[model samples]
Target chain A: MRPIVLATDYGTSGAYVGQLKSAIYTVAPGATIIDLTHELPEFNPRASAYLLASFLEYVPPESVIVGVVDPGVGSARLPVVLEGDGYTFTGPDNGLFSIVARKLSKARWSEILLSSEPASNTFHGRDIFAPVAVQLASGSTPRLAPAPAEDRAGIQWPDDLHEIVLVDHFGNGVTGIRYRPSDQERIMKVHGEKVRYAPAFHCVGPGESFWYGNSNGLIEVAVREGSAAERLDLKTGDPVGFDAAG
Target chain B: MRPIVLATDYGTSGAYVGQLKSAIYTVAPGATIIDLTHELPEFNPRASAYLLASFLEYVPPESVIVGVVDPGVGSARLPVVLEGDGYTFTGPDNGLFSIVARKLSKARWSEILLSSEPASNTFHGRDIFAPVAVQLASGSTPRLAPAPAEDRAGIQWPDDLHEIVLVDHFGNGVTGIRYRPSDQERIMKVHGEKVRYAPAFHCVGPGESFWYGNSNGLIEVAVREGSAAERLDLKTGDPVGFDAAG
Candidate 1:
């Protein structure tokens, strides 16, 4: 069976992430659940959308990816399942899957029609998305109605965003801009600080700030042996600009 | 097959935790790996010890738990396999398993005689502990030599510690004290701030600080809808005191 990958904003703090796993394991004891990340920028599904999309290439094909950065958990947002390329995505309809759908070929969106009301209004990740993901992984058909493409959240969002989307534990600021080797000569500006390009950390001196194509194929700002987030005062949603190197 | 549970201080950053999972999957693709936590107090096995012990009652029986909070990864510390109660543990023998051993009846310690030197000195969690855990989970015997109890690190340490061992993402301070129903009347003091006892977070008003028995059965300090870590200026390793309430 394809791995059930969990991507959430639940920071692994309390019982929420554990409950997601328990909810999955309760039915499918043999299912393999991989935590893609639980520390996505909290409540900012727009930023999380780009970051989650960046990880799609690394995840195994045909995997069930559950992205739950829903700030509208108790609101009227729809729960969705989007089949992108060979992967199946489950999460709230709040544009979290928008970038993911765009990156994959022949993506299809569907609204999950629950068999019954969820146990809690505040935790659809455990109640709705996890069970739905388990059903997908187990090859069982869930009640899903075709969702219109026009109504999809973030459908009109730019293919690539130009803001810091995640600050990882190393203090590396992962921006939404895709990094290609062709753009090696460009300088990236964040919070008024100019960062030149480097292929990798060792290419730069200690404590020097630089931008690089991270392993996930995104432009990540980092300070060698230091915190780039601290040096540049960067956080998620901070705008980043690109310019030709002087 | 028994499940492999990972507890580390790797903090879900960078690629350490992912690599540990990959290492296990590479050997045992069917392994059910549960991340008990990766956010243990960094480089301090003494604190991690009490916290790991607190979770022992909750983990499934006969699970192979891999605990890696080693500050001396590349050093002379031995990689050890410890059996406590029915569960097997693999990690650096730097007192990470000390408290765990004390908690379980008939615990035994053995030095892992590696067939080859670990590929990387700094990441025994990936190279040593993960593989060892897979072997145990797969019902295979790893090459282990009996380690004397007298040579064990933290063998003579106190049964309980009086310090905050972990500050969780919710800003709740988890101390080393085991909470029982009898301790409800005791007042807890941390960093010169006195806190009363409450049955749980909901028992107190918003922003009111109190101490309670956490789900894991440890005394935790928290402020409802606020951060106890900030409210009491608490951090891991900060001393905590208990007194009878007037």
Candidate 2:
């Protein structure tokens, strides 16, 4: 079985993540589970979509990603399985898989039909999606209905989000803007502060805040040894606009 | 090969943890890494010791437990590998493994001698401990020298601690005390306040605080649908003394 990459809003200290792994182990005992992350910004599938897309490029190829940032858990939102390039995503159809779908155009997708199996209305991520993720990772054909490529029901959001999508443990806010890396000075204006871009933390002065293309190839705001969010008083979903002076 | 369980103070939002797992995977390609927890309170090995001991029972048997809460990382403090009943631990010998050593008495231990291998002066958890952890998990006996169990250097702490060892994300404070389950009105006094115990959250009134034996069999302070740490002004290592009228 290919590895299962678990990405969820289930905080690390909690029991939910443990149960998710237990679920996978019970079904696919030979499966390997890698945590892409669990401390995803709570209940924001749009942001998780980009993060899932970004992480897909870094993880093991042919890996099955289980993305679960579902806020509309018990709602009428459909559950989904997005088959990206050499990777698979299992989550809600709440636009969580949309960016991943966009990232790999040749991607195939399907909707998990409504089920009567015992599950909590608020935690389908565990009861519903996790079991299906194991099935996919275990090389079993899960019950899936085709979701056409043109079906943009969950993907009404913009292609490249301008808002802050992720705030890391160090309080570095990762923006949704994708850019190529270069030594040339790149700058982004957030709120009223101009964040200069550097290639790495060493290139910037101590305690200096800068934007850089991170290991994941996305523009990120960071401080050399301090917190970028704290220094700039930034939060997720805050806008980062192009620097006019640049 | 048994699984590799990572217990560290390395916060999740940083690159350190990803890099740590990356280091493990580079050496032990088949190793399945389970993050026992990362958001350990920074640099307090006493609490981390108890937490590590508590987690040992919950993880997979015969697993390699890589514990690192090294405040004295680059110092002359020895690095050690403890072989437990059915598990192994590799980390700094700065009392991080003391509780686990005490928990399983038949355990054997060894020291990883100062080596010529290139290592970071600061980040030894990544440079030194993670690689050793991978070696243990990958069924390789890393070069280890005999260290007597009677060596009182790290195991001098009390068998059962009386102070708060951990304060978790939900603001619940976990103490190093243990107790049996019963319906009796258990009580604990802290900071001139008498805290009564309840079995589950539902047993206590909403927003009321209580002490109980948590899942890992340690006493914990929690508020039902509220922040116990915030309300009680609790931090790690704060005193949680015994019940007087028990």
Candidate 3:
């Protein structure tokens, strides 16, 4: 079995993410669980979708990724299992998997029923999705009902985007726009400030904010030794355009 | 082999933690790495000390815990490894593991030589400690020169403390003081605000604030549906005492 990956907005603290891991461990002892990230912006399904699409490249094939940025957790939204090119995702139908569901070469989705594992009004991530993720890792295909691809959450985003998707610990803002080597000449502007293009952090001058390709291949805004997000007041979902100064 | 756990102030979204994991994977392929928490109060060793002391109980025995709350990351602080009761710790001797070193039975201390693994001026957690952790997990015992136990960082604090250790996403503050079920009648006072004790969150009405034992067995301050830390202006290291309203 491939590793079980967790992508959520559970942050680094609190007991939520740990509980999810515990749930997996209880069923699949010695299962490898990789935390791609747990710092997604809560209640922002589009950003979660974008992050999942980019981050899915890093996980091992056949891995089951559980993404739970569902703000409508207790709402009438559906629970789902989406099979991407080679990855499986189990989470809320609130569009968290929208981008991946559309971009993957082969995307097949099914609505999951949770009669055995009753979820609370909140935290279906822990109750419904986690147990289901363990069952998937255990090689058991649980019951699945049909759901239209249009009903997927965050399905409206295009295959690529030009907005901030993540702000890293160094305050570098990772944009949803994939980097093209041919487009290194293209600079990005945010909040009226022009950012030139740099290939990596050390390539830029100290305290100068520049765009670079992160390890995950997203175009990221960063300073040499300082924080780009702080220097430019950039955050997730902030719009970007071709720098007028260019 | 026990899982390798990580606890640090390396906030989510940095290439820092990922780099550490990548370095570990380079040496130990398919290693199971668990993130205990990364939201520690950076530069505050005491808070990290308290958090490690409490959180260690949950990790698997014989696990190598790479704790990296190194405010003095590049400083001359001695890099050390501690063999605790059933687990091992690797990080700077910067007091992050002070509590666990003292309390764990048969604790052995040693200074780690980094000549084999040259550490950069910054981010020893990635270059030095992470490699050492991988070596430990690989079942290879590296050289450990003798070091005085007193030389351990942050060893001055007592076993039991009365300070706040963390504030979670829900605005709940996790305190260093362990909850004695017998002391339920003893209300806790923080910043002169008295907080009555409740066995659990559901015991209180909506929007009500109370102290309860979190799943980790630590006493935490929380509001039923609100944020206790936000409402009370509580933060890590705020002193806690018995309420005068007794």
Candidate 4:
């Protein structure tokens, strides 16, 4: 059986995910459709890209990964399939595969121009990417779809360090910092001040703040029994800094 | 936020899935835990094995897949962590990963000897596997805990031709055939006659019997707007046969 993972910005409240699954199953009856996440924050391609890149490696080889964060559904934005390292990615030409391609040894891409079919202005997830993914999962070659346009721009991660891309459900601000146990013995510096590590989110003394590298390889700031984002007045994209000192 | 996928046979009725997620979040604060499926049949390792082997590739790579379908929880059974390309799988040592490992390269297995701790007999999904999965999600090493023994016996797919593993929500008896479209196109010679394929479950001719693959990839025998399992005296695990032709 073939496995297909779907990552989309479509929230779970609608028929978007269901319709897409039905369409795929319509074409490939044996295909196992896995929902990576339909709850990606709406139309946030960067967020979608990060979420996809972080989890793409776990999918089995030969599995088709369908990403539909397309804000440019019916526009000139091209639908593309990136094939590499025993896996395939199908999504809009928007930089969805850029981060993914960086992680693989080899990647070949093709653009999907199936826009001539009757498609909705609002839902390319159901119309475009979903069908293309079904075809791929059914053993159709990537090149069988429309050829990808040459010189199309791929996505790029920000390098200026001006914003952080994640916030916890409890509103704790986290940065992309890989944590190590050795760092625990050292004094942690966040935003230029020495801080202590809390055992749990609430382990810090009341009103006392701290920083630690969370399991997801990110630096998280939290306040005991309180909202850290509220206490620090931090939002999702706010910039922060940290350093470990002996 | 980090994504964690839960795969279990606990079925979605009780507080099992909810409590597992609560325990996970309590340990790894602010993490987003996704329920892959709680609808797996109870205590059926082969079904859980097949389901996980089929769908685990669709989840994000860093996501922790927590699978609990153990029929031998508090006994000599072992909790295990199997690390493979881009994903981590936590479950009992009942051969859940055996099917998946055959399809992947370089699987690192570790036994979680957490049985020595205070644990529950009925709910290892909540006590052992869930907590260990949270620690794993929080970036704990698999070797952090006592090493579980390796080379445990794996699950064997039932060789009996007529065995059924699941009866879905719609009362469709899902057989082990794992149907594909090619199989659906070819008529199955059953009971000394060719059984024609019905386009949909309800597409069977009036007062006629039909069989076809349902949307979830299981071969189903059904009558239009009727229960074929009941009419045909078919219960789960009963042996049934279809000619290889279709």
Which is the leading candidate under lDDT? 1
Per DockQ, the best of the predicted structures is 3
Q: Candidate 1: list runs displaced more than 4 Å.
A: A1-9, A12-27, A34-37, A40-246, B244-246
Worst window of 10 by summed lDDT in candidate 1 chain B? B198-207
For each predicted model, how many residue pairs clash, with residues at least 3 apart or on different chains?
0, 1, 4, 12
Off by over 4 Å in 3: A2-9, A12-136, A139-246
Candidate 1 on B68-180: residue-level lDDT in tens?
A: 99999899999998997789998988888888888888989999998998999999999988988988998899999999977999898787789999997768899999887
lDDT scores for all predictions? 0.85, 0.78, 0.79, 0.63
Model 2 residue B133 CA deviation (Å) reads: 5.0
lDDT per residue (tens digit) for residues B193-218 in model 2: 78887888999999999998899988
List the TM-score for candidate 3's chain B: 0.95
- For model 3, residues B1-246, the per-residue Cα lDDT tens digits are 456888888876668879888988888887878766778877888877877777665566678989888777777898899897879999888888888776687788888876664657788988888888888887887777988887676767877678888888878888987777887998899888889998655567778898876655668887875778888999888898777665
> Residue-wise lDDT of candidate 2 within A34-71, one digit each (tens)?
77688777878777777667665556677788888888
- Chain B TM-score (model 1 vs. true structure): 0.97
Q: Clash pairs of candidate 1?
A: none
The alpha-carbon deviation from the true structure for residue B228 of candidate 1, after best TM-score superposition, in angstroms, is: 1.7
Give candidate 4's TM-score. Answer: 0.48
Least well predicted 10-residue stretch by lDDT in candidate 2 chain B: B114-123
Candidate 1 TM-score to native: 0.61
Error of 3 at B128 (Å): 2.1
> What is the C-alpha lDDT profile of model 1 across A152-232, one tens digit per residue?
989888977999999988999999999888888888888877889988899999999999999988899999999998988
